[model samples]
Target chain A: EPEVTQTPSHQVTQMGQEVILRCVPISNHLYFYWYRQILGQKVEFLVSFYNNEISEKSEIFDDQFSVERPDGSNFTLKIRSTKLEDSAMYFCASNQGHFGEAFFGQGTRLTVV
Target chain B: AQSVTQPDIHITVSEGASLELRCNYSYGATPYLFWYVQSPGQGLQLLLKYFSGDTLVQGIKGFEAEFKRSQSSFNLRKPSVHWSDAAEYFCAVGDGGGGADGLTFGKGTHLIIQP
Candidate 1:
């Protein structure tokens, strides 16, 4: 089965540093999303991308966060300034359509020190 | 706004015992419900989804869920859980707008299967 893949299984960055997390979604999927889960917390939606632009985003997706499809098959999330509270497991997901089954990546653990 | 509630923080069940994880969701219109499992150090794996079919939906790994609209719940059940069933189970609800939207996930219930 085709699956989404994320790079840098784990990352540790200093506070205020910029960090970029990369994901390669399933080839045929049309929608991509980024979600985060703080330790012992529920998974929270960050943003959703479609047609090369952001379709929807949550309040947590503030100015410090940006997502891009820098190139075909690559979706990236960049945190302009990482804060200690930014430490969490970030997951990338993709689905073929509105009602299609979504597949998630193993997740990139971001630890902001 | 959509939200999911998984009341149980942790549950321990002996091997070969039956298991049920409770999930309640708050959404308007008809909500699209889903159950996902995450093993240690792994991503969320979809167990099943309920769209507009029968209230009872069967999923992989011999797991099934019943969607009770009256109770606003979608509970996951496994007749016989194995040790490998130990993991975190999350219930999610999606917007029924037929647009590409993110899912609202519950806090998740940690399943501990004792051998």
Candidate 2:
């Protein structure tokens, strides 16, 4: 019953400020992903990471956003300049590999003021 | 391209009543379908998934889904629902077109259980 864990259950930041969200995926997982959910909207895929590089990303994942595995256990998402529209619940998910079950973290609520 | 559609935006059912949430998908090839539930202010929890094999798949919390290839639908159902089952349910489809990418989720359905 291993689970993905995200730090800073909630975050508040001013527009144009920098913010970083962290996630620790399951130890054996080989693929990691980041998704965002705006209030009352569908969960949208942001980015997917595998083999220490981005595998696939959506149009919403623009230059302003970047993801990195800073260390063995930490996968982080950095928003270079946050905008008010960036306010949403960001979820981190991981899967062992293709066709494997993906587990989601409790999510980090990012509130950009 | 892949997408998921959850027809009902919101549904209300009395306690101890049966429940069914509809989901449809648009994807080429044999797609991987999944159902997830999220409590208020929490992350998505995997209820069940269907890759291949039996069209009917049983999941945790007394939930099950049927995959209809002809209709391209994967509907979730529960014989009896409790107040605890009140949450947001999302239907997602993965790219079985051969890629290790993420899933495309539907807008989600908000379930309300009357006491």
The best candidate in terms of DockQ: 1
Tell me how far the alpha carbon of residue A90 in candidate 1 is from the true structure, in angstroms, after superposition.
0.3
User: What's the C-alpha lDDT at position B23 in model 2?
Assistant: 99
Q: Write model 1 residue lDDT over B15-44, tens digit each, in one string.
A: 999999999999988999999999998999
List the TM values for chain B, per candidate: 0.96, 0.96
Q: For model 1, give the TM-score of chain B.
A: 0.96
lDDT (tens digit, per residue) of candidate 1 on A1-113: 89899999999999999999999999999999999999989999999999999999999999999999988889999999999999999999999897788899999999999
Note the Cα lDDT for every prediction shown: 0.94, 0.93
As for candidate 2, its clashing pairs are none
Candidate 1 CAPRI level: medium
| Model 2 lDDT per residue over A6-113, tens place | 999999999999999999999998899999999889999999998999999999999999999988899999999999999999999988887678899999999999
